[model samples]
Target: MINYDLYIDGKWMASTGSSRIEVEDPATRQVIGSVPRGTKEDVDKAVAAAKKAFPEWSRTSAKERGRILRKVGDLMEQRKTDFARVISLELGMPIRHVEKWHLKSSIREAVYFAHMAENFEYEYEAEGGWVRREPFGVIAGLTPWNYPMEQITMKLFPAIAAGNCVVLKPSQATPLCACMLANIFEDAGLPPGVFNIVTGAGGEVGNCLALHRDVDMLTFTGSTSAGKEVGALALSTVKKITLELGGKSPLIVLPDADFRAAAEEAVYSVFMNTGQTCCAYTRMLVPRKNKEEIESFLAEEAGRYKVGAPSDPDSDIGPLISKRAFERVKGYIEKGIEEGARMLVGEVPGEIKKGYYVKPVIFTDVTNDMTIAREEIFGPVLSVISYDTVEEAVEIANDTPYGLDSAVYGPAEEAYEVGCRIRAGGVHINGADAHITCPFGGYKESGLGREGGTFGFEEYLEVKSVFGK
Candidate 1:
């Protein structure tokens, strides 16, 4: 197994304790790697380093910062294949998608943020006064395992480009990518201590980082329940915080759309990344008259997405991240049947003796109030809810506590108009392209702050107003 050490103050050192957390390959259930199980002591040291590095780093020229970040993107491009393979092994995503969705997106965002930093107006005149965007010191970032490589890159690129130091605590289940990234940053010539990493349980290292007095800002991406705990801890210090939490997002297939294409889009939204995506379109709202026809198309599309090992070139889907996650997805399927939702595409499997795999599930005749329709089931499961009217479809779409990502499949004019009514942060109309420069976050309980483009970059910055500057 590959063993790793905690990275603090530009050095990779063993933790204060001898404990290490083993990371398993979801496809094989074999221990593929291990990282030091960090303690509060480690968090303290990382935070101290970040806090010490913040002053000079914050004052460094944006041009210089952009150069380093741009170099990081260049190096990541060279190792794209290596990064994709590791993520496929650790997170159970198919190799075909890992390169396109995870690694390429990370590299693109890094480059995008680098250019943004170079041209960003840190200070602008506003109504007879000058407003400045200043970096917050010692940001504590916690990322989830679903998109291990991209998640940390999503936070780190902009946060560092904004001239803030960060102490990141990646999910212990998939941390090898984090280790790889730290090495890249070092190679990119980032100033010592401008970035740090501590890997361990959320309760230990994450908790310490959240409440650490030196941390001026907190950014987290995970489940809603865990986010609340972290947000609470950060609140104790009254630090600036951003939480990108759970989502039960929806995809509305309007009457005017092509049933075949819309059905395909719906399945892709959920089955992509094995449905571990926080912003996945779990709920599908279709017109009542076309429900059965659309259901048939959905099932057929899902059938094409076959499950196999991540190493297999043709595998469309792979295993879940862990046994616990596998069991959780199974539990949700059982619950869907109990709630009287009609099973269209999936069933609870009879014990498979090997990998943590589950058949993709789709439930029809679902109501907004059903547990299956409302909760965020982070698996390859979709809830198909039929609506009588366009207004009803919009209402059902907005019924959930989450308002993350969503989509509307219909004629151009109709879809755009309907998309505007949804409460979600993003609405994909007619298979719109999702670039790295869009503003991404959620409304309501799904999240607190944006994570891409101009708004996201501003999250790490504190606003200042200077009169007659």
Candidate 2:
């Protein structure tokens, strides 16, 4: 049993409040560990510590901060196996994917951020003036459970590199991984209070951190409703805010495309991480003439994904983060059925009964107004809608409330042309590849700011213009 505690001011401490959050392994529905259920008092202590440490940390050279970040990345690499196991146990990602992609990708994000920080321009001269980018003191980082380490790394690395201290509040669903991350920062010899972790419910510790006047900026990754609440709370003090919110992205397949290949890629896009990712391509648009053929292909591909224990190396899909998520996804699946969407593959209850698992569900004849097609169902549920022409396809793809990401599959030239017309932060053309360095975010309500690449670093920085001096 791994015993975990909150990290504050370079020391491990118990929660200031009288509550504890028990983390469970979704695969087995068993309690894996418990973390401090922090409160407003805990948030106060963390912000005070960060505020005190900011002066020294901000004074440190950029190269020195980059070196420390590199050390942290190295430590993360050394403990890849340990981190992978923890992610599998707590978040219920397949062990193989956790080791192969999740752990390594998170480490790479840190290392990449460090490399970017080394060459980032903190100050530049303009017409009769100089623009300076400085860190916002005491950032409050609130990350989600889906990609705990990746999201935290993306937020913390840049904030620290930009000379800011952080008070991170990772979701209670996967707080153990956050604790492990705190240990890595400690091992890397970061300055006292430069990085701290507070684990608890969003309404308690998370809200407190967002509302804390001492916190200069607030960065959050989660649902839009939650984002709105956090934004509202931060408005009290007018703190800087950056949000990476939800998505119901689309994957459009033209009649000229290879149906088989597109179907496989579409399934992979949404089903990866059990469809918990914010940028998952949940809605797929196909040519009306080839709708039946595309549906057959999608059903065949969906049946190939094996949903089971996260510990199973060969399992393609694992249980959700908790029973609550499982129930919520199930309810959405039921709503889709009641709304008259045709279920082509997988059932609501699915195969597994003991764990919080739902198999891949693909719904055909789904209209844009259907609940499954319109709402952000963060599960392995795919909705297929039909379009008559290229213009119609583009219209359908952009009809949703989200504009975070979209994919176009067809002839290279046609796909590229359609990709240009879509209003999204990022577009995948012909399943080319997902660029880590590209700016990732939405245009409207999907998110307020970008994450990944150079734009992400700018989120933690404040700009000041110095008059002719």
What's each prediction's TM-score?
Answer: 0.98, 0.97
Residue runs of model 2 more than 4 Å from their true location after superposition: 350-352
Q: Taking the tens digit of each residue's C-alpha lDDT, what string does model 2 give over 1-469? A: 6667779999999877878888888888889899988888888888999999999999998888889999999999999889989989988999888865577767787788888878899899999899999899999999999997888888888899889999999988888888898989898989999998888999988889887889999999999999989988987899999888888888999889999988998899888899998888899999999999998899888878888788777898998877778888998999999999999998877554678888888888899999898889899899999989999989988887788888989999999999999888889988777666877888777888888889988888899999895
What value does the lDDT take at residue 370 in candidate 2?
A: 90
Candidate 1, 1-469: lDDT as tens digits: 7678999999999999889999999888899999999998899999999999999999999999999999999999999888888888889898988988788888888889989888999998899799999998889999999999889999999999999999999999999988999999999999889999999999999999889988999999999989999999999999999999999988999998989998888898899899899988899999999998998899889989988989899998999898888888888899999999999987896675678999899999899999988888899999999999999999999998989989999999999999999999999987786777788999999889999899999998999999883
The global C-alpha lDDT for each of the candidates, from Candidate 1 onward, is 0.91, 0.88
Clash count, one per candidate:
0, 0
TM-score of 1: 0.98
Q: In candidate 2, where is summed lDDT lowest over 10 consecutive residues? A: 99-108
